[model samples]
Target: MGQGARSSWGRLLADLGSTLLEVVHGRIPADRPVGGVVIHDPVDEPVYPENSLVLAVGVHTPDALAPLLTGAGRNGGIAVIVRSPVDLTDDVRRAADDAGVAILGLARGATWTQLAALLRSMLAEDDIGHTQAESLDGIPAGDLFAVANAISALLDAPVTIEDRSSRVLAFSGRQDEADASRIETIIGRQVPDRYAQVLVERGVFRDLYQSDRPVVVDPIEMDEVVTQQRVAIAVRAGDEVLGSIWAAMDGPVTPERAATLREAETLVALHLLRVRAGADAERRLRAELVSRAVEGGPEARDALSRLGLAGRRVSVIAAAALPDEDGDASEQADQERMAARELLLDALTMHLSAVQPGAAVAFVADTAYGIIPVADAAAEDRSAALSEDFVRRISGRIPAVVAIGHAADDVAGIAASRAEARRVLRVLTTRAGTRRVARMADVETESLLLELRDLRASRGETASGFLARLVDYDRRTGSELVNTLAAWLDNFGDVPAAAAATFLHPNTFRYRLRRVAEVGEIDLTDGDTRFAAMLQLRIRRD
Candidate 1:
């Protein structure tokens, strides 16, 4: 077996110890690779080479060090070592530390030529070993684990396979070599935001998406977050980016290693396609089950049982996007609406799963529905509160209204719950300025009023004669009598309170009331008349 063409900065430090070089300020990033060595000349225009360890032979001033370090950082150089007896300033040290580049000083009597020759020898030895390895001719496409294992062995580094969203699908079982960010990525199934920010700022993702070749990333050190060097190869099928294969390199990746990573990318893409097909089939099955349950079919209970939700009390929730005020309705707006719906569904799925496993959520007829299990008496209350919070959080992003149904004891009652939720949602859509999230129980009074109104309309019955006369008299004469009567009825026929509520004196209110009774030909003292008038007023209000 031959070694790969890669060597760490720590390894170079060890090989050049006899050349009287000493690390004075910043520590060596042991995981970062030192590709080669270059001697800096102050007379010439400075050029920093990528992955090269630079030597500032006789330059020591901060002005000279500032531009050199800054240029080296922009070009992706690893480190800059200077000869001793030159005064190094605090500004230069801080700059190197911020850029995550190491600063080392050589002891007296050591020359730049001697150190450069040693680095060349070590790199040459690495190349010789790499040339003896097997050719990158064929890669097995069927077994994903085998491919990951082979890449890890070939590069002698930990590897991770992730989807385009940065969700880890598979990783080499090497936790010992993993950092905090790596472990967090594996556990959370996504890259952490801090580390992701660094990669984004460096254009790492842009390079990966736009090219087929592997992109090498230098070591990153934020205030509290740090990561080792990495090489990323995009896994693409045709023009679509399927995923990526990331190798955590402890040294510079040679040409041979980069080629092997590209080969592994092809296998990853094939495996991802297969995985996506299976997921589609599974989603179809789940959608069918949800549809049947909503319809209350004979197989609904059986489907719920097969889905591991037997005998569980459940509630249905429906969310629909509210109409836009500006009424754009263009193709771009439609596309944006679709994207918002998808994001809302994704957020709801994640939230529900975190609170209760096996909760089923589906999108139907431009509305997303969730069937949440209520395991106990308190479960429904808890779920309702959580759903309210969920709606509040997404309200700014997705202008939607959410309705929740009453809890049912079994899957057979799911259809009734869904109908109730739809009814609540319908009422919300017609009314403006209502709360975004509502439950069926919260709208019971309005629901009953709706039913009464519908019954009256179907029967073709007009309003009671007492209400009709009162409304007509007020509209024709421009009188406040009808409003006064409604207010008095609402206050349980309290004349003084009604007068105060309408901002009139007590005697003036009594005079108006007498006119109201005289004009409408109704008795105010009779209990039966008062009740009848109140009912009519309520119905007319609805």
Candidate 2:
């Protein structure tokens, strides 16, 4: 019986040790008790709730404490047992020296506390494991590959990816070998059918684009000749639905079959999106760097020098990419967008390079742009006008909004000219208000000064008022005097061009010049009178 009891106690201790460690390590629920503890020797008996615990210890020597301690452990309770016997001191007794397992000591009481701590630790480990597993579930590489392979293996089905413009990027897994070939030819080509139109008429790509989940189209309901079967997954990452993967079977779709294919489709779509996203991020970075460089002059040139493209004059153009008026773009929107931007840049380069030798054009960020240094400043103007005309031509060929900026003589003018071009673009494209073409000459130092002078003169009783009065009299009466004065002064007080401006023949205008001396005012060729007539034409003419 003694041996059996010892074996039982040993087994219990082992279990308790393991369970205690797990609980204290937090492997178990936090609120769970690791083990029971009892502290005795208090005046009042402490009550613990059913799920909670307590420690009891009796205050006495070995002779007084044995029974209670022994009974506590045996009954699955713990006690702080004090014993005095043999050579064992109070410290030794507290550690339950020379006592059997039944007589647990203060050390044993601490053991339960350690066990609880161990359980808490374990719980933390479990949580970490759970999170890792969930993350794996969300985007597991092996799972994704398996799913994609499964999709490609479909016997009578063909898979395709599309951008918003319904341009196909990838096509695989076709029931018909000929269909595969046709789709291959179609890859990198825009789906001729508008996705929106398709959605309205047949509800194929549009429905797929709108769906947040998988959609299965019944082949029987669709046109048997053209669209035998269709199963698609909308490729969504965050709020953006990049496009979709559509698998078309040769026949009608069953629910079970659709469900099976749906998982694989979704996986393939997500993988495609992930791949595209990475590429897009890299491209965006490159484009942004180029954009800032183009817009930043010295800094841009520094960057260009680093890129081995310094000292080159560049022309910048802006192109807006948007949806075509007519199509349903459910599947291939992203591919179309990427292609459109690429195509625009290529087209711009081709067009510009054709005209100007060594002209380099590229996409500067989101828009298509071109840069070139020409033979002369005037030639640059002509080339820019030509480029604008060329853009207008191509814009007609492809659906796009194109805006061309003025040509600059050197890289230093790039940033400023780009600004001017953008402003002109807002004027031309947005039509937000009445716009005057922005010319560098219009904003030049001399022109600015003249404008400031005009404004200052406007505020005062200066040349403007005198000119207005003379012109007003001329309008009221059939006036030869005003014309004569204007012509005589324009001729440096000679009766010439000023008379022509007043709509009289030169000789007749000359007669008016002599008439000014006879009519109400100063001498016909007086310097003040001439200056006044000139100011009248400038400040008050319609």
Candidate 3:
């Protein structure tokens, strides 16, 4: 017997004959498989094995069946067979129907041990036949489509293969038998939100992630859009759930069909692992190319060409997480931040690609950098909008700052774009209450000032001597002369407006401006001197 074999409740009851057991409340799940048999004991705790047909050996009262069915369903049992003679109630029947658990009656003189042994032998023989048939002419290995088609053929149902995130990876092309939810999922390449919510409320996904067996979902209690039963088998690699195979069933799942689905899961897992490996390799190559372009290596232009961005106009963007206000520096917090950054970068890459094909993104140090090709002048605006949208989506989840550089003509201009983006990011991180999305063009004046400041610092130059003396005079006398000077310059030398802005009378502001000239020993009437002093004051504000 193959290890993957299963037996249906109807077949097991028929094999036992009317002398052993009979259908009572709920009909046998003709398609639902029973992998094993368990004898229910009142004194001991119930053990609900996966896909098992449970035999309630002693108690068969109507009230007992309600909790029994509910508990069995929760524990992943397929059906319950009662050995007692008590009559079944409507409430019990309804509960069993709602939970999708089948109920059966064991006739007098049928021992639990005897029924269990008989079931094992029958299932073994069933498995042997199935193993032989599969070995002869079953679905070929390593073919995801063939696997889906085979499962659909064996169960006479529509089938879909999806990643763990409920993204549809493939479908059996049997749209004729598909429900609205299934069709929607296939067309959108993702499970619809309403349908996904239903499954989550029912704890279907929890079971899928926690168990190794196929989970049977009853459509009767589900949304009307889901018109058929579903059996979700997790495609696993060791302990990891790679994806799932969803089969839409018109009726209960039979053991033969269940075994086929299990086999299909194995095949799908292998295919997913291969697909994931290939995708990872390609992602690595693209990330490396972006990294090279950002760093301005000699190979950058060639790398950009390989990524289909050689002659295209492109913009570079830098994204970094803003520091937490509370300043958590624990190891756990660090790990969490790293994971969040990676997730954000991945999302950015996906969104950028959707907006601009062949967009390349990479995470370097604490920042994520992307080289995005712009189709035309309009594409630059589109890229900026997309970047803002991405930032908004990730806000609160991960507070991040995104800086966009100006677009340039070709791959050769990528380095300059990246430098501009990095410069904008630097200023953004230092300032409080900066907008989440910063553009180089918007901060051109600030960028130039920052560059000039850096140059002065490298040359070991100090602040303008005249501005320094004005600052010293304010410090000594506790006066507002330096602030008045900054305000006057900021207002383009408008004495009244600057005084109004400073909340001082015009005559008082004029008096401070005169004091500023005497304390600084400079001519305030010169435009070039005012310009240089204003720049100095701006640079030292922080």
Candidate 4:
């Protein structure tokens, strides 16, 4: 790994220091490379890579935090963040200094989850296993924070680079010098809705996006978030608007600075393109690794290792959107289906990763498969519950089916688990959204019947014996005898229930049942007769 392998501690502060965090104790080891982010769990200690940033949630006092800091320092941790208004007492400061660990204060309103996500994003861009690409203009490719800071220096003002939706992608330091609203935006990583509304109504976005020149805007009169006027320009790649740059300036147009802003826009465009390309590359590589591990061969172990799932017990989940067979057969419809599949895959990836740590979700052809690591015996049951929850969460948006397989205790067993999941999925997909989440144990009967149907068809077989007779009679007479028998069997010989199900009178249903027995030569009394009839009906095509 080179010096650029990861963002150093100094860079973390320079990027996040203004709004999200503050240094409360110890020197900021600016050059220390933070390897990863880890949540502190007392019962199950986390494995901390070198220079880990430990998020010590709920440890607030001097007595409680002192020992944890020592432990973290011994494990090569670079810093520990505690919820703010950090105690910062003399004793706590002494402990942090003694442990050689810096203490950071998380903003009072910011969530630990959001902080972790931000840190992980930074770390992933400089992951240890992959070599860092050479810098493109003295700044690392796709390093938006560095670009934002450089642009700020060139313009001599606090700046922010934002997506078209007004979500802040990156910001330079000295945000406090801008406005209360600017500070709020920096804290939330988004322009407040009131400010966005102000901009929208003023035709600010339309004018800025339409012209290459910087558009100057009057000061907004919203709450604390809007006291300063802003100069904004759209960042574009050809005709596509990638995002925009915003600077809080004291006065009006300087031609040279606006020209610099235009040049900076081109650089930001390149960085955005690189960021998108990197994400796609990472996704493709992950899919390949997941495919290899699920196929289970000599290199399966290596794939599992790369996925961080080696030596772990796991269950495979297979999920897909129910096909809209009745939808219009147009190019637009096809694109909609493809988009739906991608949405399902993204939801599965996010929800599963939340449910189980280190889970891997990826697409293999038309199906999206998830490998969820488990520590308990009821792996499939737990997976089913999570899958059901996910399906319910996205129910109205997309109708989907999810199948969970038995626990695979090792990498060698994962392939079998995936096969079982896919087998169950095949049965569920045929059922037309009847059951959205099912495990092999829950749908084994349906799966077995499907296998039987496949085998019988391949051998050129059809309905046999009494079932054949019932089917033939129904076909010739255009009667409901076959359906009558099915309803009777399904209702466990409850005549009135079967009658209601078929929307017929009880006497009519009873007469049909009698006809079914007599015309098909089937005795409705024998257990073997009922079982054989049901099995044949389940497997037969006609």
Which candidate's lDDT is highest? 4
Clashing pairs in 1: none
TM-score of 1: 0.58
- Full-model lDDT, candidate 2: 0.48
TM-score of each: 0.58, 0.43, 0.59, 0.71
Model 1, 293: alpha-carbon shift in Å? 0.9
lDDT per residue (tens digit) for residues 254-344 in model 1: 8898788876776566555445533443455566667677667787887677566668888888877787778788999989888888888
Give the CA lDDT, 0 to 100, for residue 146 in model 2: 37
Q: What are the lDDT figures for the candidates, one per model?
A: 0.73, 0.48, 0.75, 0.83
- Per-residue lDDT of candidate 4, residues 50-164 (tens digit): 8888999988888888888988899888789998877777877787888889998887645565466556655665353666464646788788999999999999999999999
Task: Give Cα distance to truth, residue 82, candidate 1, Å.
Answer: 61
For model 4, name the residue pairs that clash.
Answer: 10-30, 181-225
Better of 1 and 3 by TM-score: 3
Question: Model 3, residue 537: displacement in angstroms?
Answer: 1.4
Candidate numbers, best lDDT first, in rank order: 4, 3, 1, 2
The sequence of per-residue lDDT tens digits that candidate 2 reaches over residues 1-542 is 01011112232234333322111111223233323333453465444222222233334454545444344434444223232122234643443322222232232212332323222222222121123321122544224433433666753455666566666666654435434323533653565443335555767666776665567655432233443445667765433465666666555566656665655544554554445433443344445445755687556765555434466655555555445545557568667777877876777667766877755455765656545565467766766576556656666555555444566545667777666555444434333222222343433433333454568677884543445455566778967565455455556644456655676677876566554544445543456655656655434321
Candidate 3 residue 327 C-alpha distance from true site, Å: 5.8
lDDT of 3 at 205: 96
| Model 3 agreement with the true structure over 1-542: per-residue lDDT tens digits | 33343656665565455445666666555666666666777688756667877777666577887888887777777778876564777888777888778777665534454455445555544321123221112443235677677778876788899888899887886866767777778889898887788899989999987876789987834453445788998876544677899988766667887788877776676566445433544565567677887777788887777777788788999998887777899999889888898888888888887877888888877889988888787888888888889889888688888999888875557788888899999877767775888897777777777878788889998765887798777788899888999999989989999999999999999999999899898798898888888888887774
